[model samples]
Target: MIFVPLPYVVALLLAILLIQMVRRSDGNKPNLFFAALIAVYALQSLVIGTRWGYDIVALLPVQAILAAIIPALAWLSFEGLRDGRSPRNRPLLLLHALPALMILAFVAFWPMPISLALIVIFLGYGSALTWLAWLGPNALGSSRLDGVGNAYRALQITAFAILGSGFIDVIISLDFAETGGTHSGGIVAIGNVLALLILGTSATVAGTSQPASEDDGSGNEIPSPVPSAEDARIAASLDELMQTRSLHRDVDLNLNRLARKMGLSTRQVSGAVNRVKAMSVSQYVNDFRVKEACRLLANTDDPITRIIFDAGF
Candidate 1:
């Protein structure tokens, strides 16, 4: 009988996933972080496959370290996707180092406390991901533009997938304790494979569909000059800004930028635009571009390509 390890299958799938993530990443911060997260997961699975399937225990410490880093990477990737920024701060990297350091210390000397701490890590990050998932489409920030609902849905699913992974960790930890060192590795291998498949697909979908970043250090919150009840006044100011400045001519314009230009909160801008324009911010912006395009097509002698660029279509 020829024996095939499930971990090998998992590793192979993850390798393919990594390649896709890399090809689709396009240097976007969220996508890059997501790719890194997938790479880490792949490395962890490779270690597990070698350890359990091949009985190689040399990389056990590496596996433990990878496990500690997974949650942090997952959270960071989600944050990058949400906020459209990925900080390269050294302190953040150092903070993530704490988990791996604790695991390494356990591997070297103190082994008893690490188990409980691992559970804490899992449940803690899982709760956070679950909360973000509960935020629904809003959690996607500016990425919640036209034709992007599917990507947002994929991200929500991925958040739940992360939460599921935390519960799986709890189950595995309990199994480890209850079995007195006789836990079935096959079950864990299967669970890891399934979870990785889900995460990889969701990450790819969400990452590739991400809108280009429109933030230019101008999205910082400023006090709303008008009260919430005065949405009409805000709407009027926004219209004046759009008409006078032709801000809609910028292809990368978003609600945040519009709000910043008008000195209003995103919520205020969104509400005003929604109530007054009777359409989404993206739709409202497109209306201006479409009108301009129609004008150019009807009256202009310029080439269609030049007219398209000029009209910001």
Candidate 2:
């Protein structure tokens, strides 16, 4: 069946790729939450594509994954957005787990009422996650955030919306299984739109243009950019600064000075740094240097200021 395309597919794909990139970029430690997200998506595809989807009993794994994945992700996504507070609504999150376990356990023994209950629970999470996902973009305008985080967040939100919508629509499918009348009309329409949202978000979340192994600054090796006039200058200057062996020795490298040395448009330079390196130029330069200084402070006879300078303060 044909599914319309939308922005959500891009988001979905990005959500998958972002964590993997972050993992590779930072260290080999993969995020279980993000990895689980990828599995949930694959299972969703499997359920939708195969004949096993029609058989709820055979779809136990799919349903179980959907139930567990959405709520946990919703909570985690919310935490990331809010910068991880102590989790005030612990009870609410737990309630979500209960319904999932209930569905999983009962499905093994009972099918009818348990299926209806599962459908209802799915609808609830579907509606909630979808709303939260769409809500993030509206609050954080597409133009406001830096490219990497914005793209990652956008994908996160869009995927939740699409998959969430799919869950809700599927619930309605169950509700209208027998009659398939006027009540089903709304569900069908909603399902179609949700399907498109899923497609778009999925593409972005995956970052499929590059293989899983490569990470050459685009975060995905989609071929190095041509290095526009602005980027070329910034890259050259940064390379020069790094090679100087003295500049990196300083710990307090000012953005204004760097801006002056590069002589390119500061805005372009900043954007390039963010998109290419995932950090502001000042941060890119100073943070690691600071860490080095701290290490020197603890381990050597270097004076604080000397260490700071050595670290490129």
Candidate 3:
């Protein structure tokens, strides 16, 4: 009788998810990053299963490096969703990679601190993601309005999963200290599988909500100007455009596309909507969609499903 390890089963599931993501990818950076993150999780699961189940002593460094990469990739994938672009600048990219590089350094010359470093990396990135999610769906200004809610929820789940991974590490560390690693195997087997599954699934959902764009080059960090006459004019122009052109009917519409139609940067459009409407761009557009759906439901005999599609929901 062959006893199959749980992580191997998890790796198989993650591989399926990775393949699905790759097949569905539209060459968008966020999608690709998400796919890579899933791939890494699959590989890490396989490595963990082998190392623990089969006692493969040679895979320790490989597992450490891969573990380090997961949190960084998760951060980059979600950050891209928020910024509407991957980190293209060399400096920014390097800064994001610093934590993983440090882990690699520890793995190479100083293995004692490897576990501590990983715990720190996971907890730090998890906290960062939590903060991003706490800012609300508006923070993901690049996601399609119709899907922003799901993306926000996915971000929240991923944040919690990452934080859970950190806590798992703490538990394993405590177990090793108190019991001489007696319970580490059981903990890793169950804890890691659950964490990877949650992280991978949530990331896949978030990727589907990402807009297909290389870069809008809009800096979201800049302070939004107070609602002024200029903002009112921009909001009026946007409203006129949406009403006249029925841009809300486009199911794929996103902030970048709306801004392009208005001949303004995404920041300008989002800021104007935020200031004048006192709502995120997504909520503002979704309001239009809801109204259209309601009108159709009241006046037409179309199926609810058809009306939903027509409303771009």
| 162-219: candidate 3 lDDT, tens digit per residue | 8999999999989988999899999998897787668666757655644322211121
* TM-score to true structure, per model: 0.75, 0.42, 0.76
- Candidate 1 ranges with C-alpha deviation above 4 Å: 1-4, 25-30, 81-93, 142-151, 181-183, 204-229, 243-255, 277-279, 286-313
Using lDDT as the measure, what is the rank order of every candidate, best first?
A: 3, 1, 2
Q: What is the per-residue lDDT of model 2 for residues 1-313, given as tens digits with 9 covering 90 to 100?
A: 8643332343355465555557654454343444555555545544443422243346555555464555555444433333222336444545546765776666667755654565565556556555555543222221212222343454565446545654664666566676754454455345545654664455455443322223312233333444567665676667667667545564334434455566654455555665555554544555456667778988999778787656654
- CA RMSD (A), model 3: 6.5
Q: Residue 293 in candidate 2 has what lDDT?
A: 79
Winner by lDDT: 3
Candidate that would win on TM-score: 3
Better of 2 and 3 by lDDT: 3
Cα miss at 235, model 1 (Å)? 2.8
lDDT comparing candidate 3 with the true structure: 0.79
